[model samples]
Target: MLWPYQVKTVPSLPEDAVRLDVVEQRIVPPEEDVVLIAHRQRIVRGLRALFAAGVAALGLLVTIQVVMIVEDRSRVQPGLVMMAIFWLVALVVGYDAAKGMLKPLPRGKWSELVAVPASGLATLGCRIQWPDGRWSDALLSKVDPALAANVFGTQRLWIVGEAFRGATTFAGVPGHAVLGRVRFN
Candidate 1:
């Protein structure tokens, strides 16, 4: 399963800044089908739907309360104010959830791989430097902890977008084609 990806150099970075032997390469998947990719996408959609429903329900309830307060006292009441505050909080949360679903992740370009310090853990931090000097730290998710520990800076990687939803790691290197989810927040 070879996935095609577009490769472009950042104009901001000098041509001599870094040398990438292969700008574009065919990405081979570790497995015929990556279940984790689909599962994460489904989770993203489910969360978006849940937040949208919450926003609608809260909006309606707040509207009804405001109308009732206006009819009974002909003025804004403390109860109405409280309801409004709750609605505002719901709206903010819903907005953030939806934004995450809508906004596209920034295109990641593999620049350099930094060595990971020895840690007795299944996951190790992989820091990726972009051409523009921007750095993104991602956790290496491997089926075998031994393989993760052996990953060195010599490994090559290519950046691919939309390969996996909720994925902070976009660069694909050999052996571990798909790194674990990246943490933007």
Candidate 2:
């Protein structure tokens, strides 16, 4: 008799026996929700980005208009200068809106593994890992060290990064865990 770890069993069958295969791990309900969570996150992130860009651009435009009005102007009339600034602002706002609409938001949230999947091996669309139990969800395809420089920056990591991390770590979907423990096929 071999030890349990070393033992192997063959199911009883006909002369041309067909072996029975058992799956040790199967995807739980939450794991299935990962796709949905990813989609939602993507949408939220896109909206957040659009809002940020719009606010920043508006602030900059207002500042420029004030500076132009206060400072001495030679050739360009204040009204023309203001119109030019407004046009520039409009272009920026339109561009930002387009970009926001095009970009997808990925879902993300803060919670313990117990809230989602605790500990289980999971496969990413690409191989990625959480070394320090910390991960960023960033829109950028390439993970930039600069983006992770501060707590705020890392906290607001992009949608893509968040989705990827959420799928793996189960840190997404406000109430429901995106996954419980993922197993590869």
Compute the lDDT of residue 51 as modeled in candidate 1.
72
What's the lDDT of the predicted structure labeled candidate 2?
Answer: 0.40
- The regions of model 2 sitting more than 4 angstroms off are 1-32, 73-185
- Model 1 lDDT, residue 16, Cα: 68
lDDT for residue 126 in candidate 2, whole number 0-100: 23
Candidate 1 off by > 4 Å: 1-37, 74-77, 104-185
Candidate 2 per-residue C-alpha lDDT over 72-102 given as tens digits, one digit per residue, 9 for 90 to 100: 5543356655765776677677665455334
Q: For model 1, how does the per-residue alpha-carbon lDDT over 64-122 read when each residue is reduced to its tens digit?
A: 77787769866656775677678778778767645543444344333334433333245
| Number of backbone-clashing residue pairs for each candidate, in the order shown | 1, 14
Cα shift from native, residue 38, model 2 (Å): 2.1
**Each model's TM-score, in the order given?**
0.42, 0.27
